[model samples]
Target: MNDGTTTLPWLVIREDDNGNRYRVGRFATRAEAQRTADSLGDHEHQQLYCVERLGARKPGPEQNGTAR
Candidate 1:
């Protein structure tokens, strides 16, 4: 368990019809992520993006944690 050569996976970012964004899955390749995104049901607001580990946890505008 001492191997530090392992690379983290890329994440698929999904946005729902309500404009809610979240991480859908982690993939080893962009092609795989694109496949998964394309497989999702048709939705006007739904969109997918491929990002690295550090960007996977990016929150939506509503999740900014600022009090209104």
Candidate 2:
């Protein structure tokens, strides 16, 4: 099913020890993502990963239509 539509770009994602994932940044190339991740450095229970955004959002707890 190729509609010839453009998709989202690549992104640098970070994951913490608690199994939580977040989008750090977005880049036009994988190399850029890799460099950013490398420059970030590694920490205990923390890691950076490269993944495509694909027009999707990062997973997290849903809002209950109320503010904290």
Best by lDDT: 2
lDDT tens digits, residues 1-68, model 2? 15975433767676665768788787776666667766675544346454544365653435111111
- What is model 1's C-alpha RMSD? 8.3
lDDT of candidate 1 over 1-68, digit per residue (tens): 14855443656566555667687777767566656666653445435443434455665655322111
Residue 33's lDDT within candidate 2 is: 65
Candidate 1 residue 17 Cα shift, in angstroms, is 3.0
| Model 1, position 18: C-alpha lDDT score | 68
* Alpha carbon lDDT of each predicted model: 0.53, 0.56
**How many collisions between residues are there in candidate 1?**
0
The positional error of residue 10 in candidate 1, measured at the CA in angstroms, is: 2.0
Global CA lDDT of candidate 1, please? 0.53
- Please give the TM-score that candidate 1 achieves against the real structure: 0.48
